[model samples]
Target chain A: MPNADGYVRTGRGSPPVRTPTPRSRRRGVASAAALLVTAGTLAACGSDDGGASSLTWYTNPDAGGQAEIASRCTEEAGGAYTISTSVLPRESSQQREQLVRRLAAEDSSIDIISLDPPYIPEFAEAGFLAPVPDDVAERVTQDVVQSAIDGSTWNDQLVAVPFWANTQLLWYKKSVAEAAGLDMEEPVTWEQLVQAAEDQDTQIAAQGIRAEALTVWVNALIESAGGHIIEETADDPADIKLGLESDAASAAAEVMKSVSSVGGPAFTTAGEDANVTDFEEGDASFMVNWPFVWGRALGAVEAGTLDASVPDDYGWAQYPRVLEDEESRPPYGGINLVVGAYSENVEAAYAAAECIASPENQAYYFISNGNPASNSTVYDDPEVIDVFPQAPVILESLENAAPRPLTVYYSEVSGALQRIYHPATAVDPETGPRASELISSVLAGEQLL
Target chain B: MSTTTLPPTKKTEPVSAPRGGLSDRSKAERRLGWRLAGPAFVVMLAVTAYPILQAVYESLFSYRLTDPDNRSFTGLSNYWVILTDSLWWESIAVTVFITVVTVSVELVLGFGLAMVMAKALKSIRPVVRAAILIPYAVITVVSAFAWQFAFDINTGFVNSWFAWLPGVSADTDWFGDKWLSLLVICLAEIWKTTPFISLLLLAGLAQVPDVLQEAAQVDGATWWQRLWRVTIPNMKAAIMVALLFRSLDAFRVFDSIFIMTGGANGTESVSFLAYRQTIARLEIGLGSAVSVLLFIAVVLIAVGFIKGFKVDLSQARGE
Candidate 1:
């Protein structure tokens, strides 16, 4: 017999080969064609750089605020260079990952970046940021927020230019404060605030979720109590110091436990959004959050979702103190402008960064994006004061704000801290010591997570 | 059907003879086979095999993306650290638990669903099938968001609707506790994937031969007895195939956990742990190590199922 239809071979010492059916053979050809098309498209993906040199500035997701700034900077450039904005992932860690990957490969297309403050040290240590020019540094640093300057520096060198500075404020309702017979103008300790919430039969909203926000809260509480997470023994991981088990850390944990325990059912999982939502709807009377809440409240009122008088009823003060006598240190958060080390247009990038973070632009960003300006002059501007009635308190809070631990291993430290201190009520004196040890072990490569 | 056209093996050759008598036509046919398979094979190798090999190569180094200059060869230290770490073990345990619970639950529920679709009237079969497939068609991230919102205390009605129960409070947070959070994650996974399993099983059910079932019924066998002895035994291949696929998918649960809890409340799966290291921390070396371990674990799981079930995988895999 002869083989027929070319679909099978069954003879002599060979294993059987079942050939493809006509339909399957057609599918094979189709799929192969598709693969070629895909490969061709991938190969064709190269930059179409026309005559003009374009700078790509990577920014955190900011609802087109950064895009507006990019366009403004480009127009101001007067044909020297064009600026384009590429939105980074919304999460700070994700943004860091993308930037780090590109910088490690020395991708020169990355001209500038909007950086989270805590990751500045890591980027600077890795030499991913260009050194700030002396003239530009002097121009940007005048009347800047101290914490913003502190956050953008690594090894005493200003590696990035400060753009905006954010610090949490103790926001409360006037009715809740009066009901509890508490003064809103003077400083109030966390203990006093918790008691007042109990007295008024209301809740305090804070970020308790296991995220960078939780780490920010923990660091603030510890810093306010005169404790530091890392002592900066050296840039080396083995020499890093942790003050997690100190008396100040214990005090911070005490406040964390109390606030989280009494916060409510979802306290363990509440984040910035949850707390803000609850506060807007009157579920909570007190919240410690970034200045963005003020703009959110006003917007809600304008949108008719909130009562007209709610903005008037809102009151603000400096972040609550961890102890009665100690001055409270608000948590600092903001975006910094950093020039990419591998950028072909280093001079142009620095010029654009300086222009974008100028006092006038900082004030504009404050009003538009709700991000507090790092330049103190921006706060003193009449328009900023008119828009933010609590501008003075914000300036004061930014002064005393405690930046999160500046470490080259911030991602590792933050992850370990969030893990050990999660469900904030679980944080006790022991959590600090445990977290410190874990951080040390993780950094030293003895532990992996 | 075409077997009669094949050349007789006895006349063709002895067992040890070389296949040297092939005509030019046969040689051209062999070349055509390779030519047709070439592009897809190359693409598959580039996309899949290259990354896997690269991951294995990177796992041997001490590489952090940020600290690019500091990378040095570390031999097996990365793997050693992961093996010794309790967090890795915890993630693996969580992954296995999720895989077992979700796959088992999905298997039972999917079978029930497939049965309904299979047994329904011809007129309604299309509608029932479409409805069953709706969850599967929804994007994984979107379905996860829907479940996350539905279970949220402030934004959801689940708590208020179930508040009358003794232990269920009106202010309950579904993601607060470890067990409950895992339960909710499993619920989301099952809801999304049970339809897929049902679709596969439906095909197998079609091949189960209703005449055998009717004969069993005529012989005085109860419905349950017929199901256990006749129906299940006949659909063993389908059941095994579904288990193999669903279990592998469930074992790598990431998106739901990442969105709902961000791996908090002790809910991080192995894939999530790998993600945190590789993407969040930029620790490429350690992340690759974790990925390799996860890959090994998946292979072991597949082997276990294949060995225990004695499954003839060629049936499901096809020619």
Candidate 2:
């Protein structure tokens, strides 16, 4: 993963020393020497003085989907400019760190960025992103999902163009639900899902790691109960108000405690990937996860790693509610296209970003990468619906999904929330108020955590 | 790169210079020494000193990487905040716990291995030496991942093997509990680094005179006494060096904790906390404060170790 500073971040996020493959290990000495020379070269050419026509897009690491999009957009450039992608670190926080550091330095090599939705506010607040051109903004925002548009906006201004949107659906095993006598067509509550899992002696796979994933889960629950983690937010950090002391928060905490009581043994350490691994083993009866699981299960079946009938039993519904009467607000996540303020060819980069986020491209990305599209029109595409039979459910979830707290201090808020609510079974009514105080104090810069 | 090019030609010529009047020869030697060290000094300052000074300067401000324009001079408030935070102290406590446990265990285990290599069957010395170095050769991250997988309930065998033991569940999630996660982190640390300690101790063992052991034995000294009195005292410098290096390395432990538990379950070391604060949270001001504290802590540890052992670092640096 090439960070904006041209440093390779390895071993997840802890340190730079990663496990090298045998080939790299054999060439370690040569690579070390090469790295020193490359570092010097990168320092000398910190801007786009060499080739103005070539644009560099710093994309979050994905499984070849963004790379393909870059190639497609390059073709669509039609000799205007060639776009190349540099993969950022795997972790979102690391990617943000690298970009923030480089952009702070006004490194002009950063022409485009695939930014995480929660970070757009921080980047925009710092003036790292170029103001969206009116023409491009109108075209990009015309047919996109409302939640995606909301996520791309910071302080009522659209700082980024929506590319793709993601929201979790309640995936279940048909046989397990049947065994528990749970209806498939009706909206489910977290209480009912937990009881059903308990009745059938199965697990509900969900991310519970003490990271951003935990914050995502907590925010979704709270939002579904008609409460926002931050009931009111402002550009000024001191003006933020956390809604954690409300009854809705209590309801959310109760649901979490109940669900976690019956979660799998590795619930505390389980990330999305770990949850999916257990789900694929047919041990989990239900899971709340992003759309990628749909493609993953099919691929597993096609590879004969999973039972052929598992796909037949696969089903999905809207995100679970915290209360029986309230509608669920699933977690919203996605990539947004942001033009760098320091880009030499800002117009061309914006044009390429538009090309990359067009409806046709969004539909293609959805079909290929299993990431739901931000463009609502893409959901109605015949190929998208054909590939994902539950496309409507994902689209509906995206429509109602609530994003994590939108603030320039989102990192501090989310980090504190994760620390307080982790080990999900331990969350209680008091957790809400405690987390609120901690988040408030931290964001106000009166406390350190 | 230029430093690498300049030092190779005249490296041996300085030592062979003819004797002269004391003042003239000393002046010439000093000039030559400064010329030889000048490039290295500049490069070192550029790489290490600049960043540290920048960190110190940033720590005095209210700086956020994401909010560049919001920076303001805070004048030591960041340091004051960190010093008062319970989380900072907890991280320090955890780091010290890991450092002490892992280094002590490694010392005992490494000493045993080194003894075997030094005094065991001569015919198997080559095999023993190679075996002892295997863990040292494996990458830290790879070993950490291996240990993580081994302790994971879903993918590992450790839980299954311990299932039959009392109070051990077959589905135990080692990472779910704080102490257990620390245990696993220490296990990975000890597994990866014991070999390095052993290799260093093995060098010390080679310097222990066999004739002294024979004389002690002929004088009716028991094996245990000879080992405690003669062999240990003879290798005291080596032991002090090994302890200082290992302890310092262990105090900065980040890779295993990050890979195995990700500083979750209260297992975060000070370095892990710094990384989270700086890279993950983007609180450059607060993070730099933490970094400066960590640097001071490391320096204190090195000085404490060196002073405690009376190890001459000037000699260690081959002055």
lDDT of each: 0.86, 0.85
lDDT of 2: 0.85
Candidate 2 segments whose C-alpha is farther than 4 A from its true place? A1-52, B1-31, B119-127, B165-168, B314-319
TM-score of each: 0.90, 0.90
Model 2, residue A176: C-alpha shift (Å)? 1.5
Q: Candidate 1, residue B173: CA error in Å?
A: 1.2
Error of 2 at B285 (Å): 2.2
> What is the C-alpha lDDT profile of model 1 across A273-335, one tens digit per residue?
788878887879999988888888787788788887877888889899987888998999899
Lowest summed-lDDT stretch of 10 residues in model 2 chain B? Answer: B1-10
Cα RMSD, model 2: 7.1
lDDT of 2 by residue, B1-319 (tens): 0100112123344564556534667788889999999999999999999999999999998887777777899999998888888889999999999999999999999999999988779899888877777777777887888888888877789988888887578678899989999999999999889988888888877767688778777887888888787777767667888888998899999988887887787888899888987887788898899999999999999999888778654432323
Off by over 4 Å in 1: A1-51, B1-35, B317-319
Candidate 2 chain A weakest lDDT stretch, 10 residues? A1-10
